[model samples]
Target: MAGLDFLNGELEELKRQGKYRLPSVWESGSGAWMDIGGRRVLQMASNNYLGLTDHPRLKRAAVEATEKYGVGAGSVRTISGTLDIHEQLELELARFKDTEAALVFQSGFTTNQGVFGTLLQEGDVVISDELNHASIIDGIRLTKAARRIYKHKDMDSLEQALRESSGYRTRFVVTDGVFSMDGDIAPLPQIVELAERYDAVVCVDDAHASGVLGRFGKGSTDHFGLHGRVHIQIGTLSKAVGVVGGYAAGSQALKEYLIHKARPFLFSTSQTPAVAAACLEAIRVLQDSPELGERLHASASSFRTRLQADGFDTGVSETPIMPIVIGDSARTMRFSARLLELGVFAPGIVYPTVGEGKGRVRFIVTAMHSDEDLAFARDALLQAGREFGLV
Candidate 1:
């Protein structure tokens, strides 16, 4: 306790800098609208893209699995944790992605860590996009492989990075399918072309794109029609799936290798039966009801267009994740708080989450939001923006 006294000074500094904060207490499920601090607000800040977190089918599947398999997986997959449901989920994922096979991980972040750590070695070189998710950066950092970062979505920069890394035994090109902050999609077609030319293995982190892109939400690779051309496809079961887990879809050999070598998969406990069942049902629901994604895209387009027309900077976003850039960190926080006051629950993303002077309030458009819900959110945002002199 004596040695940790310096934490008090750090906390004070964070507060002074307008960075210290606590998560809001959500009093309801992560639906299009939720109750927070006794106030019912339109929830536009979560990753529940399809709003399947509270879907009846998912809930039913979870309950059934809980009854059948109890609560936990009890241990890691490599030991006694692997269950029939887990295998079924992986099979379903592989079929959904059109991959030879697939492997599941504890979370999206862990999937990145596992794949990067297991695949890349001392002589390998990983070429990444500059704005890839932090999980990707951290995963690449954990490996002994050399890392090269290209400018975000710049194909020429990616090619140069590829050329420079040609000498390495294995050239791995990694990128996020949908960049979380700016919401811009990666130039996967160009990336694939370059990777082909350089013989680099293409690894796409489709955490945000999985349930938001492609036919029936197969993901970015399928959206671009790259399919089997891309070697590795990493996805999350949490975001659009409305559950908790991550996965890697690719060749059978890759799945075999990661199962044996990926430290995260080998060490972490398998997903709970309920979670796996719910995720499996989520995929089925997506396939059964493609209208959910269509509705989401349409709503997002309208909302984003409205914001842009209102003179708000919704940076390079071509997807549902919209970032209303508010240059100053404190101002962004103030804007977010004001939105809460106006019956919206969007959160502010600042500093380390984004670049300096790039603070913003991120809004995630979901399929569950009705026209009335979005209209309410739009009005609240504009009111808050006008007060801050943003519009």
Candidate 2:
């Protein structure tokens, strides 16, 4: 058979296994309600947790920056792409994170790939949570380091892994501040204690935690009050902040080392001036407006409470990323399709993004969603659950 034929066969097998993914197209801006495939739908599937994506301040910043700097940065950051706006964004991020310095990447995924692959070497060890984001997993794979996986949120298992890798030159313990799939928080306090005891550098990917946790959404470190203990904090401006880019907050020396040695930062073009300017404005908006965060939390809590009361299994959720468990992948898809038909846009998450037999319909609440919107969504979901026998 031809190689092309073999690739087609593999794709067919994935479809048969209920694992093939085809994302829907959106034709509108990020908001509480969105236009999906030309239809208006209540959006419960976006990562815009704080609803800053469409904020007036961010839009204005982007517009002004575009007019002043044009569109693209035109070259790699190391050469001529490093604009004044990029430096300003970095400064704003460092201040927001309360770190000495920060380095911005084109995207969050590349940030992880750059940081892990560049920093770790052949005799080093990476002790990672089993449920870490795919970027981290791929980053670890790219490195020559020995990788160890500890059970999710199992501090004892992490400690054991650390103890077993004592002879390595460097040990890195990495975890997500918020487990994206399960919508659960990391046991950061315990993890930090373990890292300290084992002399391990702690790294947290706060992709979902930033702009949704702690006082004014300072992220997991601030939420747990372990700010200085976390060696590296990875955050995305695209999610809660409503812009496009990722940043790593750390000491000045670490930021300098990444800027010099990290392949992604060295090779990739810096973020567009518009994106960086928008991100800076986003940070300011987040700091100035506490109401947005409160509304988001209140909506999330209401949704969680209603779902639990309605007999839905929202697995260990402590944040806006709520997962309504539906064990069968096909059933989950049907539930999602039914939701779409009912003018709601919550999507079914299936393997291998999640584990087998753990398929769920993930609901992401935003500050823009009103009480009426939440009720509409809740009623739609409950109806879908009944229709699909998921309840």
Model 1 steric clash total: 0
What is candidate 1's lDDT per residue for 1-391, written digit by digit as tens? 8999999999998788777789788888888878877878889989999989999999999999999999998988988999999999999999999999999999999999999988999999999988999999999999999989999888888888887877899999999999999999998998999999989999999999999999999999999999879999999998999999999999999999999999999988899999999999999999999999999999999999999999999989999999999988888988998998999888889989999899999999999889999999889988988999999
Full-model lDDT, candidate 1: 0.93
> What TM-score would every model get versus the actual structure?
0.99, 0.98
* Weakest ten-residue segment in model 1 by summed lDDT: 14-23
Off by over 4 Å in 2: none
| Candidate that scores best on lDDT | 1
Top model by TM-score, which number?
A: 1
| Candidate 1 ranges with C-alpha deviation above 4 Å | none
Candidate lDDT scores, in order, read 0.93, 0.91
